[model samples]
Target: MRLPLLLAAVGTAAIASIAPLSANPEVELAAEDMLAPYYAKLERELDLPVAPAGAGLAEDTVLTRIGVGSCNHQSRSQHMWAKIAAADPQLFLFIGDNNYGDNGWEGDAALGSLRAAYAKQAETPELATFRKAVPMMAAWDDHDYGFNDAGASFTPRRWSETLFETFWGSTEEVRSRPGIYDSRIVGEEGRRTQIILLDTRFFRSDLEAMPYSETRPPLGPYVPSTDPDKTMLGEQQWKWLEAELAKPANFRIVASSIQVLTDAHDYEAWENLPLERAKLYRLLAGREESGLVLLSGDRHAGGIYTDTPDETGGEQLWELTSSSLNLAFNNTASNTAREPDPKRLTDFISEENFGLVDIDWAGRTFTMTLRGNQGEERVSRTVSW
Candidate 1:
């Protein structure tokens, strides 16, 4: 069987030195033992430190418009920022993969090349201009978290957390925590909007991939885990999430870096952690009137889906999946698997796109739009909750 690149990243002698811990991940290593050579490599390579971005969004102000997008390749054209800026979004969520710097290695100085990718993104003038006009919040997925499809066992994660917090301007409360899971309740009472950012990587258990020798799964590369002992959010984050949900808010936006509702595919998602997905459903079970919505990125394609009252056992939950701000997977070369989601209400948008959420407080309704940089609205759905 061909080993995945993540496993190959540790093929060098530097990583071999930590094989007692790396080879047997469950033993776990201290942050000090795994951090030095790893972070030192990135520091030596960065053109300059990645400065913090977009702070001081007022909680008393009303937020009527919101935007979200992910899966950005730092090297690609960032023209989408102009379109996002034009929309006058009160808040923009940078959900993940904001910096693509994975060079398939993590244990030693291999991260220098990855640091350069982040430096390139920070220097993008379009993003700089957008940050000036828009107050942004961010959460990282696999790539920007330092490697593609990585989790807790990834040696450099502690250092990766520091880099993420520095670039995105994470809150002091977030910095004090281990994982980036946090909640922000902005806007005044009645018009309050709660943003729940999940850190699916920092404390997550490693994923179990489907063998390459076996037929590739129809959608992506991974197998579902039935082991309930395995966790996606870890104990502390789960406790944090339950408490965050308890705080009352007019509308709640749960931002996950990976898809949550679609189950047909074997790709990295809440589906892989079945019990955890159920727990989320149970948490939102009675929030039918909360104007709850789910936002996710990571899939190269974009689409809209729903978890009806019957499906989730509470309210009508809609999930808007927008991705690949520049990296479109429409071409067959990207992948051959067809995403088969029976619950999807809109056609899969396989082109470059972003998601827009417009709220009409008077009507108690919200609209989710999937559009391209040219203002092409490929799919849209408005829900009255």
Candidate 2:
């Protein structure tokens, strides 16, 4: 088998340096036994012809609208799908933590279970209704990557990648390529929008465990240093991202699973990968023509951030992060007072909320609304370019 560039790097000295815990042999076997039948079903499903897209939705359509969220489990949050589908957006971007794959990887079997979980969620009436209207795209986080807060050091990283590919239904061309950062262009003339999705977790370095301290809350907050060589998108993906951003688009949206602006929620984020975060921001700042905006999910809440240049002279871009189709066990706090930038670093923050973004192709103005479960608008802001 020809190893892709990403697999080649991962199989070599890089991953070898960080020895990972071996999975339990029995769990692997059990997961495989459960997976066999699902794979067969998926093969049949993929064989079905995809529906044709709307005519007006051509590559050069004037405006493009997108819906985004993260940290969803199938058994919970079944109600949110209908409301989300009603929005009738152009695309749905899942920002990761899509599944809770705590079970050890037992080859295709483990993958089968993961795929089955996603299927149940996707088949929900609300999501199914929306799928008929729009296509979906996604990137993986730690949960879906087979471990919580893992990196290149994860034992099943390769297996996890394959499962992600199977679930997302990307073309073989995409699957065969290395690294998951992807770009999409929409609209025509002055209304063009470019969306760049970053793959943050697949090849990440292990986050240093926070040290315990008395003065500080239990664990002292850890922040990433701007090490020139440290990275978030990995080498190839970073190169691809830079080239993608350099293109001429009316607006550019960068989607990340973790907060890029806020320093709070110190477990994992761009803050933990400081050099990579700065490199990304500098890229946006340098691209004067591309009207850049950021999108994120993970915190299980929704909020927005506007880059406010400080007196110390730093550029700040905007970030809009919405999270959780339903709250997870540990992250449920995110649904209650879990602001992405609690320390007041971000311009706006909210908990127990979702978001909707609207774009007016002719007017060149967009509205972003933070909403409650009942679909009542809590916070609304407009962005015009």
lDDT of each prediction vs. the true structure? 0.77, 0.62
Question: Candidate 1 residues 314-348, lDDT tens each?
Answer: 46679999987998868422432365567787777
Where model 1 places Cα greater than 4 Å from the true spot, the runs are 1-26, 31-48, 52-55, 104-110, 212-215, 286-289, 309-311, 331-337
TM-score versus the correct structure, for each prediction: 0.88, 0.76
lDDT of 1: 0.77
**Residue 302 lDDT (model 1):** 83
Stretches of candidate 2 above 4 Å error?
1-57, 103-116, 212-222, 226-228, 309-315, 328-352, 361-363
Candidate 2, 95-159: lDDT as tens digits: 78766554343443234445555556545665556566666677877777666676655544555
Task: Provide the global lDDT of candidate 2 against the true structure.
Answer: 0.62
Model 1: which ten-residue window has the lowest total lDDT? 12-21
In the predicted model 2, the residue pairs found to clash are: 32-109, 61-187, 307-316
